[model samples]
Target: MQPGFDDPVFDSQGVFRSVMFATAYPGRIQTLESPSTAPTPLSRAAAALCLTLADIDTPLWLDEATASSEVIAYLHFHCGARILREPGVAVRFAVLSDLGAMPPLSFFHPGDDAYPDRSTTLVVEVQSLTEGPKRRWTGPGIRGTLEIGIAGMPESFWSDWDLNRELYPRGVDVVFTCDRSVLGLPRTIKVES
Candidate 1:
């Protein structure tokens, strides 16, 4: 695919379909065909997410480190999403460049029982992604089951996740982006340690 300032011939509908499939089947590896060459701190998975979710209605809050002009321009051109600064505000999408330095997962809206889908969906960019030691995943999306060794996440992430999971249908969903791969951790999936 050609990488340029203009938006590539990305199929937003297809990307959304893939995202749905990924969320419906969490812990399963899914790939998105990105249009760009994949820049540092911006993996193909993150790029695909920006394309799929960010539209005129969705406001995106990017980490200070990753909030560059090039990134903003590209996202604007492709997704036409409005960029914001605060995490607790009305943004629907939040991108974290430094996974280690990210704010507690509790910072964003976790939605409510009446409108669970109204919560923010965070796209976390990490240095690497491997099965973590503390937790085991076995839910609707797993084939048999899988072990995930989370890397570069804050110590409080898992605990926060536990609380988020308790919210059931009213919690935020998450996507971990590394290199060219994406992993979904929807609110519906249960995580056991």
Candidate 2:
């Protein structure tokens, strides 16, 4: 299998910081420059995220399109993350590649009010961040509102996101990845398309 992170410590830290910045400012796109490579169907940003965030204790879930043997092996070897087929509260991180067949957000862990940080963080593979329906985001990190277009999400995505928002502090957070670009959409943000 291929190795992960050219400089495991520094590279992972850099990726982690980029992810944090994205999470803090929803609708913002952050570029990642990881030296690691992932198997087919998984973008460099997504693979970098898995390597930076997942560990022996983390449970990761991969959607049908991202569960290739090579991808699984890479994650296992580099991240030591447990990959499960089922979507449940036990899942800490999820990688989604096929949006058309994406399951409802309710299927993944939402974490309880007391443990919201334990909820699943979704890493979605998309076509482009600069194309698609424009959506306005307003919430904690934005000055007022931020409008951004994200391509390749399913038709039900916004509706599901709305429902997820209704859950308030219990829903999942999303990170969109395309090539080496990444965008964040934390549950704390309000989205209007």
Clashes of 1: 7
Q: List per-prediction Cα lDDT, in the order shown.
A: 0.76, 0.89
Write model 1 residue lDDT over 147-178, tens digit each, in one string: 77667777688788888888887888898887
Local lDDT at 12 for model 2: 89
Root-mean-square deviation of each candidate, in angstroms?
A: 2.7, 1.0
Scored against the true structure, residue 46 in model 2 reaches a CA lDDT of 92
- In candidate 1, which residue ranges exceed 4 Å CA deviation? 1-10, 131-134
Model 1 — TM-score against the truth? 0.87
Tell me the tens digit of each residue's lDDT in model 2 across 29-145. 999967556788899999999998888888899999999999999999988989988978778899999988899898899999899888999999999998988888999888899
The number of clashing residue pairs in each candidate reads: 7, 0
